[model samples]
Target: MGFLTDTTHMHIFTWVVGIVLFLVAASMANGTKGKKITHMILRLFYVLIIITGAALFFKHMTIDSMLYGIKFVLGILTIGFMEMVLVRGNKGKNTGLMWILFIIALLATMFIGFKLPMGFNFFA
Candidate 1:
């Protein structure tokens, strides 16, 4: 449980993992032939993402701040919504509301993730 010493490695890994999760989840939503398999993989991928995130947070526990706390809560909501959609088993319902929330959360995550100047620097 060490901080990623090489920022590049962390960035690359995160990108790869995120894209894979997105692809799998999207494919499942699109009614892929192996929808069940894709769903399972997506679930596992999400679990890993959360676990790794928690580990990183623990590593930097002293960095606790309102921004990080908010992000954590958002992440939890994202995962909860994802689970709900997966279990609902109705394409139309899943695509309508949950997917929209998922996309919004994803975009928000990206925005905060890069520390983009979105009118504030919460990490500061």
Candidate 2:
């Protein structure tokens, strides 16, 4: 548990890879095998992101429980919007709203994450 609690590097890496995979999968043709494979890998990253994020959240939760709680919810919403966008796109449905929501949530999550005491203090 010390390794997980020591730093935010693992959590950051998972989300960055997840975002890259999401873009790659989203840009590919929906019905293609490549897209499906990428999507599966992206889903694995999603799980990794949640696990690492939860570990960090629990580790530093005592500092400011309410803020961390908000960050956790925003992180979940960001992931949800990402999945919705990909699924709706694959189904040939409109995904404009989901994309908008995804961007907003992602930006908000990143901002709050940086502001937190544990991570890099770029905001400070």
Candidate 3:
């Protein structure tokens, strides 16, 4: 439990890997085996991100609960947009709107996350 107690580093690592994987997969041709494999690996990273993020969220739940709650929701939306963009793109459907929403949600989530008491105080 000690390793999981402070998950900020783990959470950041997961998201970084996830983003890289997303870009790799997105660049590949749709319906290809390599793309599918990369996507599956990316999905695993997504789960890791969520689990680590939840741990951090619960650990800091007492400090500015409202802001943490908002961060949590926005975090979920960010993940959702990431998945939507990939899936829709892979299906050969237009994902322009999803990409815009994904960027917005990701930026908002990161901004709030860094401003939180548990975060690195980059905003302060």
Give the top-scoring candidate (lDDT): 2
Best by TM-score: 2
lDDT of candidates 1 onward, in order: 0.57, 0.92, 0.86
lDDT of 1 by residue, 7-67 (tens): 3245336545755665566556446657767677767767766766565444443554555
Please give, for residues 12-99, the per-residue lDDT of candidate 2 as tens digits.
9999999999999989988999999999999999999999999998878985458798999999999999999999999999999999
Q: Rank the candidates by lDDT, best first.
A: 2, 3, 1
Instruction: Pick the winner on TM-score between candidates 1 and 3.
Output: 3
TM-score result, candidate 1 = 0.66
Error of 2 at 7 (Å): 0.4
TM-score of each: 0.66, 0.96, 0.93
Clashing pairs in 2: none
Candidate 2 residues lying further than 4 Å off, grouped into runs, are none
For model 3, what is the error of residue 22's alpha carbon versus the real structure, in angstroms, after optimal superposition? Answer: 1.0
